[model samples]
Target: MAELKRKVLTLSSGKQIRLYGNSVAISRSLEIGEGYAPNILSGNNEQPGNTSAGVINPYKLTPDELMELADFNIQLWMDLKANIRRFGVSSPRIFTGESGKQPTETTGNKKTGLSSRQQATE
Candidate 1:
């Protein structure tokens, strides 16, 4: 197999994590799903809480601090997801449409532009 390109993400604590393309990302996600499936199948339906993930907040944070923490968590998750190649825009070739084009008003008089009621009548 060909070598996959990697992007290194540097954390706030000076830790670095390597990000990879779709192949590894998909595999990792699927592995997580598979691990969760067994617990769900056996009726261990407890949520995977932050404590389970080994994150413990040692301080009694204020509301503002909690909000900041939540924002940081959300942003980090988004950054990770965005960096995973398959989860993001895979290619530039998939054009949505021509930009700055305005929609034109259509009359129901023509075959292609007929309204549902007009078409049904025909």
Candidate 2:
């Protein structure tokens, strides 16, 4: 079985907690498989007024500030990639009909630990 490399995460309380191997990773199958559209929370177009959540630049900074904002984003992504070594991918249960295709009646969406279906098997 694949495993996620352990890493430490610093909480806002100044406490460091190790993210265990059981920590769930992003699902590439459900995210970009045969039939999947990116969700609203997908951080794609992230400009001044092009955020996915809503249009609200609370700082009201000038365009020059965008460089600083981008720098922060780069640092965050770099850190994440460096620490995270493994990623979980979901293989959803799709009930097919005679036509060989059907809408997903039960997809294996899950948080961390054993998946909903995996738990059932256990």
Candidate 3:
């Protein structure tokens, strides 16, 4: 599979902006993989176009943080359902996780278990 390319935009104040595009077609001959390239030459103009003035910083979060954010988002959706239920809006059921029985050994394995060792020593 072809990797996506990261587009770079240079602002007038010398700040650089990086973005990833899904795909870019350059005729039927040449194709480039996705990544952040420092130098992007202009096609016709001598200078590159400046970045937009009001661009904001993108959100960066770890996997655990993202999961917590998703949980909050689901809660917000559930709260909003009260307003739209009269118009046939249904609250979607969201499952956060599952519960399972704790594993336990019944025979000789139980006596040889780590918990048994702690109890025997005590």
Candidate No. with top TM-score: 1
What tens-digit string does per-residue lDDT give for candidate 1 at 64-83? 88789667646544544544
What RMSD, rounded to one decimal, does every model reach? 17.5, 17.4, 19.9
Give the true-structure RMSD of model 1.
17.5
Error of 2 at 33 (Å): 21
lDDT of 2 by residue, 1-122 (tens): 23323455455666655554323332222221121233312234655775465434555656678678657546544434433432212323322243334335335645646656666777
Residue pairs of candidate 1 with colliding backbone atoms: none
The stretch of ten residues in a row with the least summed lDDT in candidate 3 is: 93-102
**C-alpha local distance difference test of each model:** 0.41, 0.42, 0.39
Reference-based lDDT, residue 39, model 1: 19
Selected candidate, larger TM-score, 2 vs 3:
2
- Evaluate model 3: give its lDDT: 0.39
Q: Per lDDT, what order, best first?
A: 2, 1, 3
How much is the lDDT of residue 78 in candidate 1? 52
